[model samples]
Target: MDRPQIPLNALRAFESAARHLSLTRAAVELCVTQAAISHQIKSLEERLGVNLFRRVPRGLVLTDEGAALVPVLTTAFDRMSDTLDRFMDGRFHETLHVGVVGTFAVGWLMPRLRAFEALHPSVDLRIYTNNNRVDLAGEGLDLAIRFGDGSWRATVAERLFSAPMSPLCRPEVAHVLASPQHLEGQALLRSYRADEWPRWFEAAQAPCPPLRGPMFDTSLALAEMAAAGHGVALLPVRLFATYLENGRLARPFEAEVETGSYWLTRLHSREPSPAMRAFREWLVDAARAADERPDLLRENALSATDQSL
Candidate 1:
């Protein structure tokens, strides 16, 4: 038998209600009355000859048939959305989607993006920021900059740079910090990862006390907190170089730890496009130049046209 004619409204109602598992919530989202949504769902179930939902005392629950249908609908909708996104620019430029860790973006990537645009004027670069943890394939990113040991499966990884952690705070706070032992008294800001403080303390040859302070999700936020004099933060020395140079922040002590490095990664299944290849070359060259510049140790000229990122 051929597929029965399904009303778009009824399918939409079912999709919304099935997503929320509540006709009332779905109705609110769709801007229709709850009763209308219920009617549409009922009509859909009747036409399809399947119970889509079970009306429980508290809320609606999806039936087995409804559960099985969700993934198919979700995929279809996502594909449609992706197609619409493709047509958004209305130009012939190739789209390059990239995901970068927040620290790398603010400290390293943002400064040098103009160079990428200047060098590859035709490539439409779309940048997304995440907190280091990213799925290269699932998120549809052509490339991602992540901090790790370079061992993600099914992806090719290239080392960008090693990031070392150290205690950073405002200059006023630094005046009182003669040695690492003095850090025990100051408010210690923390990151989502618990090991940063411990690692910095060990590197400093100071006692790693029980760290208790406001935990930030990203290192950039933690660095900002430190800049505000909220507390001292164990952060990547390279990332916060701008603040350190400009006196917005300072290193309280000289101890540092080489924790991990940033890696440029992409899915193994994808062959690098022209845009990607250009980016890879520029990125490798920039990283190499950074390594050769000894002035980068004292005052990282992060504001330069090519060196900003």
Candidate 2:
């Protein structure tokens, strides 16, 4: 059994006419005469043995067959156009869409983006910043830089670096803190995580204080709030290097807890494209390079802590 071979011109004519419901409009779009458009459509109908359209009093209307065929043709044409547009200047550009957490986006990735662009000139990289809540498949992301314990379902997680949580506050707020137990009296700002303060307290060998202050969805906001002298905020101090150096925030105590680490993740079902592979390699190498350097994160945290003391 062989399928009937149909001419592409006739298919195009039918699809265009069905979309506008007017052969005159289809002719204007296709740069063909109305009679040419009508001839191609009629040939197509003769071959298919079905009436694709009904000439109504006002304009043209699609029959059931035409309605069914229009969507399939429209989608096929759109995909083809998208594929063709990828070719530019003798190069096929690869588009890589990535989702990054807000803290990492501002503090880390923003600085290193130029290096990535310079290295991979053919990659059209798009970044979407999130508050550590993202969907890899639903949002159509190639990769996501996330903060967690590296345990997401249907995701292949790669450990990037550990971000130890510690108490950060304003200079005036730090003056009264002699030990972790002293934090009991201060207004403790918290994130959505309910156990972070308790976990830090457990590590500090002190009882967790009642959290009665404002809660933020992002560390960047918490950092600003802590810097503004609102209250003590338990944050990953390493990511707030600029604030610590500028005397906006201070690490009030040395006791820190390992709540989780940063991770580079992708859906398990997604095969890595060349651009995705390039980004992953670059990110991993960059993290490794950072780790090998003199520990600035510790130095900054200690320096801030010492300044407060």
Candidate 3:
């Protein structure tokens, strides 16, 4: 048995006519005569055994069936057009869509994207940034880079690197902190993860302070708050290297706590596309190279003057 074939020409004609509500306009758009458009639509209706349009005094109106069919055809045609447009220099550039956590995207990935592009000229990379939270399948993403313990349900994860959190604050705030114990008295900004501040304090061998301040979902905003003297934010120091370099923020303590690490993840059921596989290979290799950096410092300690990381 064979599935009934859908006429591509009829779909195009019906979609155009439904959009403009005029056969004459559809003919102008398709560069065909009005009679040809009408004949195609009549044949389509006969094949489907449904009245697609309701002809009225002024113009045409779509029946319920036509309304249902038009959107599907329109989307299909637009996607086909977009794919055709990707052909360049006798090469068809493949598109790979990915989602990323805002912190990693801004602090790490942005700097290295140029190198990835240089390595894979035929792979077009598209990134959608989130606040360490995303639905990969729902968002139609090929992969997502996020900070976590690599335990997201229904996801297959590959570890990128550990990005531990430590206390970061403005210069004036840093001037007061003589020891991790002293942080007990300062304003502490926090994440939704209530354990981060307490866990960080525990790592420093200091009593956990009564944490207080505005909580943020993204480290980008948290870093900004700390830089502006609002509070000390527990953040991944390596990710915010520019802040330390530009004197916008400083690590007040050598103590750090591991909440999670950056991981490259994709849905367990999704088979890797060619472009996705290329990106993953390039990304993993790049991360491995960064891991070998002498100035990467330890996860529990960091150097402020190690040539700005």
Model number with the top lDDT:
2
Write candidate 1's Cα lDDT for 119-161 as tens digits.
8776789899999889888899999989889999999999988
Q: Which segments of candidate 3 are over 4 A away from where they belong?
A: 1-11, 39-54, 61-72, 294-309
RMSD to true structure for each model, in Å: 8.9, 2.2, 3.4
Write one digit per residue (lDDT tens) for candidate 2, span 1-309: 677789999999999999888999999999999999999999989988899999989889899998999999999888888888989888888999999999988888888899999998889999999999999999999999999999999999999888888888887788788889898888888999999999999999998877886789999998888888888889887787777888888887778888888899999999999999999999999888876753677777778767765
Between 1 and 3, whose TM-score is larger?
3
Q: What's model 1's overall lDDT?
A: 0.82
lDDT of 2: 0.89
lDDT of 3 by residue, 84-114 (tens): 9889888889999999999999999999999
Worst 10 residues of 1 by lDDT: 300-309
Task: Give the TM-score of each candidate.
Answer: 0.67, 0.90, 0.86
What ranges in model 1 sit over 4 Å off? 1-92, 299-309
Ranking by lDDT: 2, 3, 1
Whichever of 1 and 2 has more lDDT, that candidate is 2
* lDDT of every model, 2 decimals: 0.82, 0.89, 0.87
Best model number under TM-score: 2
Residue 254, candidate 3: C-alpha displacement in angstroms: 1.9
